[model samples]
Target: MGSEIAVRVNGTLPAFSDFGSDNERAGEVESNPAMKVNTSCSLIIHENGKPTKHILVDTGNGVCNSVKQACNDLLAGRCVIDAILLTHSHPDRIDDLSLIVKEFDNVHVYCTQNCWNDVIKKFPDLQSIQHTSVEAGKTFEIDSVRITPVSVQHSNDALGSVAYVIESEGRKIIFGWDVLTFQNPNDPLLKGADLFFIDTFTYNPHPETNHLSVLQAYDLLKIWNPKEAFFINYSGFADFKNAENPYARVPKKPMTSDELAAQVMSDTIPWGYGWNERVKVASHGMVWRSTKQIEFMSPQFSEDMVKLFTEQNYVFSIKKGKKALEVTAETDIKNISYEFIKYDVESEGRRIAATTKGGFLAKPLQMLLEIDDSSDPAIVKIKVGGGTNIKMIDQDVSYQKDIHVKRVHADRLRDFLMKLTS
Candidate 1:
């Protein structure tokens, strides 16, 4: 087992539509990639600094598409969700539940009984999948991880919302959201966690809403005394202008990103815990990693595939001025020490990116930009083609969409294919 648990914040907004409500916020959401939200949050258990098991929490309305991209791009088709845990039946949280089940092969889902009933009514077609009805205070095991679902007080006790407490290898994590407060106030399990994810709503409490205000959550957070805390599911601006509370300070209508940061910072203070970093506002794609994490090496080609490229025996003519490979005559392809080209390909509904790291990373991996003499007419391209099992790497790629080649040391691939073959 690896020593680190990587918490990837897949999504953070209450709903994507929250930003669309106002034109200015909508513009910012479009302009700033970080401000854009999706349905999110997943836990990746790492072994030897590589991802082994993935547990997804809350598949929001658009999370499946994002998860699909992550599965292909970041994970290089290596990781799949071992299990999915649902917190409630809110549209923003469970709308994409069916999509996620279909995306992955053979996955199990666990949701509280109260939530499960609503889930079935919402998607009757999903009743037959591998699913389990869980109850609050029940503890279950997945691999080496222990998960306990503790019921929390949301607006509806009828829907049966609960927060998950995950423990593994002496590391405890609380993934709490859409909460009013813990139903059992004095539950010993709520305190002293290594990673804490709590809900932060408007600056002031609104009785009609299910979520806890920043102040209410703050009071509970101080007692928990976690090493690191992140506030997710936030929609905090524009409500502070009308604070009726005597203790609360006032802020006006326009809240810049800077002011929001400062406002959030003031509330998230490390009160005598001797910690430097207090609570953080979790953003999309944010990762909270263990101190022992090593740089992940993305999946490279298989050894069998690498052996296929040796047919060309190191030949290329590189034009440094134009940053392209040059070949007109069959004579232009010459025997050289190496032909270094940084390239990307998006084909067959999958993305592959190759880059030169340090030096000589490609030769051993055999991500070759070479010509094949085995075919009758001969084929000239990167070591990728139809029916060839290709693997993706999280290395340098996609400088622009489609295929972006930083530098190629051979004939322009299209010219070589058409001129020689035709």
Candidate 2:
């Protein structure tokens, strides 16, 4: 196995001056472009292994010098940046591109063809750097990681914006910035991500066609259900110090940092709900490492309770929780026309004792299936069955047919109990 993948946040732009302002006191953080240069740029992703590779995303003003200094001080120059990926052609997002090209040799710059043209036209003097054009939906590999671009709506329609999905060793991550909306809701490329960073500019819902509001971001998280999500792209309106009407209903004071020797400024406006545990507001200098573990629920099921019931598997459907579970099965395994009886549940040890009222031709049956809820994201312990109480409807007799299964069903029950707190 190679080393682990790491993503580091270099800076975050301060929110706009009027962000989260009420009829009362207006917020204080200025929306000047000069201040944005200090906050809004840089992500250094180190894909570990024998041949470790470092990839940089976005180059806001001063990012090149900061990252260059970090390489020297942090790793003794062992990890050198190999490539730079642009999210858009906006000046705040690419102010330090020329400096990066001048400082680092043979660094390939990748972006949409439209963004590439915009960059050249805006900065004609900086043509020496190698420019590589990438199209949406196309994928490119660097070391063990595969990256794909998907189109996103933004204020700068002429330059456009693209969100990237990076996959490596069964792990997936997404990076989206300055995004307004997605072209498709069910884009397979955007689903089942392990971790993602998205644009969250305003706390309240906004009718603007450009930036995403906190409410819109919450909707997207409910759909994707990533293991973790971070909100970026702040305006001055994001001032937590003056926030009187927070979207999450709870107010949080500014977070201080020991490294910076100052209060760590935050732009996050959290919204509490079931998915709140998996998402947070982002801060500068934050880092994320990929674990490559399937401990969290996918689009369908994980360790705890099975949350999905698909048409493909019609024989049985399940609804599970911390202390209660419901399993519904069809009377006939092969036919969808017959009436189905719901399984009544009672807990015993690790198993749930389930009994079904006899169907038209079937006799009442009792089944036992084990469930283990000791870990996060738990799994089902055994297949659905309590064959002892089950009898044929026509014969009115009991039988010992096992509800067969192959894996450790307990592994499927990770966090149903914990979800109660969520």
Candidate 3:
């Protein structure tokens, strides 16, 4: 179960400047080289639950002594880091590699060709350090984990960015960030990830050089159907609490802290969406475990009314108010049952009465009753049903003549009456 592991380190880098305190912001000039917060960097370790032969992913802005301490704590004083895997060669992501190499003995660094060149230019003193350049579609083994790099587009000058697909313990995890979008529909390397961490920088479609909006991420989830998905690379403006845009939707899947810990410990979840999806944004350091399942419950409708509408194949319209669901259905008058009571026809031949359903009797029926005739096809109005008053629209009034009933049908009237009360 302990095949892969990751830890968030403490150190301010230029990338993390947004997360720094205001006082700390003033001291940026003299801050430790390792304390730079250029971007978010995470240390990913892959092992077969062994201290030896572990792999570390992205050392981050390696200047913080606290970060080093955190790494030491995670290692538990076992073997030193065996290898370093770089996602990209940005300064914040790679600046700490030299410090890591200087502190540890015989550590091998693995990166893409462009990333390796960038690192070499910055750390000429560590030229003797062992480095291996990799390309897209290449698979490399790190203990029990298999890592495959997939090419992606980025906003960086060196456009050759790559995301990793890590396979271990019979499951696959995809790490996708910095890519503008999933533009390649036929890329086989993008398939079958059990978990995906995608970049969702904005709530709406504010096109940038590289990044995805929350809506784009949701569309990907519907298409990929990953067991779990998380959004990462989020901007402060895109906080969930402030997410009022209709397009920015959260994942429908359930998640828990224990599940997040398991994903992190196994290194089965990537950094972006997976991490963001599981985050609880309340008080700092406050933890909770929710065992109850969270479900999206829709509005409730009366079972009888729903059944009636379904059976009649009626095209109903629904509107939601503050407290209730308002529904309207149109049906043919002949379908209604009129079994009970008799009518007294006057010389003018019109009958008027209130329905048990609480609606006033209207028009064509009124005209026919006045004429004392059953020969005309007239519209009979059931004024109020289910607390909602029904009004005859243009189609209802113009399409037919009215029928006057001296007595209402017991069964049909009972059904209609039940609809009102129920």
Candidate 4:
């Protein structure tokens, strides 16, 4: 994507954000990844560096506080939603459909014809909403983002079930959670993806839901070879504390997020081709940003120009404990959207980031990608290299005092009239 496309892990399970609700949140369950209804929601921000399109895949538990906050962020604080792609008709998946529609009245919902009947009947408040009955093969568009619905094998509990392969700003992402397998796994649209958010409910098949096991998700990752993948909707209860699981690989206990990450890394290391960097166990507030060439930048660099947006800063992490924030940075630089281009050296009218304190680069870096903020700018306190220790220029620099006029997502209201005549 020009600016970038970003995904926010709003929720991961059907449980509330507290303990006891899911069997019991005591003991190991405390770290077993609290369930909050899984969904792969994201924003597609284009050249302006402001999100004009937001996509929600599988509205799990309807709209919780975190999910509501995400919708607000993507809509620029406006009570609106661009579109919602329903993955299946499970009650947990579409429980709050009416609430979402009631809040954002104009929000368009995309689901199967059966899903429409399922939701409308269950949630009568959505009777007047605008809904599109999506087909398996037909591709639809909401602004510049194009989405193709694909059939997936799940329980017959719902009238129908489907997955989505989304095409946004030159990136193809597949969001197919709560599925055993795709009806057409080899569909052309599923190939050569930039990112994938797939169901990894349990390591072993469960008796309740028809979702993919962790191994199955790994197999698909090997076949598709997406630039990156996120495993979501993990079941903390599906452990073998006293029971003999069907598989040898199924953990004796449910793997914590850290344990899952370590196992995923270990498993993919044998597969080679750097699959370790490609797959991850996604949790609430996890984010993935797309990287591309800065073709639109002017000839505004010195030979000694340092790079600001490098692969080192590609996978930015949100700190634990606090809520994760993924919002757009609207700026008019060589593009990598400027969080704040202070202490800059101007090269042919374009500003390059000069470090007030120390930096990985010695200024004069190419600004080829859009500047993006992975979290609340207030707490986004990182120097250079995005919290990674890499090669740096030893300038021995420090800031006397610093102030900022930044394009931050969580800071303030978006000024629609950028070029306002005072």
Write down the lDDT of every candidate, Cα atoms only.
Answer: 0.60, 0.55, 0.46, 0.57
Residues 95-180, model 4: lDDT tens digits: 76766666655778889998888887788777777788889888988777788888888887764788788887788888878787
Q: Highest TM-score: which candidate?
A: 4
Give the better candidate number (2 or 3) by lDDT.
2
Q: Summarize candidate 2's per-residue lDDT along 121-238 as a digit string, tens digits.
A: 8789767678788888889977666888888888655455788888875778888867888778579788788888877655554436367765577688778878877777655243
Q: lDDT score of model 4?
A: 0.57
* Candidate structures ordered by lDDT, highest first: 1, 4, 2, 3
TM per candidate: 0.64, 0.56, 0.49, 0.65
Stretches off by above 4 angstroms in model 2 are 14-51, 73-76, 207-209, 236-274, 292-422
Query: Total backbone clashes of model 2?
Result: 40
Candidate 3 residue-wise lDDT, 1-422, digit = tens: 35544433233222453232433222432354443433333334546644444455565653434445545544556637677777687665677777778787898987798888877888888779888888878898876778888887766664557777777657766767666655463466566566566665544554553666555665666566565555554443323333455554332122222222232223323445554334211111111111111111111244333212211122232232233333344433212222112122232323322212223653222111122234322223322222111222232332222223223222232333344323
Clashing pairs in 4: 13-36, 13-37, 62-96, 305-364, 306-365, 336-369, 336-370, 336-371, 337-370, 337-371
Off by over 4 Å in 3: 1-14, 17-50, 62-67, 183-188, 237-422
Error of 2 at 274 (Å): 6.9
Better of 1 and 3 by TM-score: 1
Score residue 248 of candidate 3 by CA lDDT. 43
Candidate 2: worst-modelled 10 consecutive residues by lDDT: 256-265
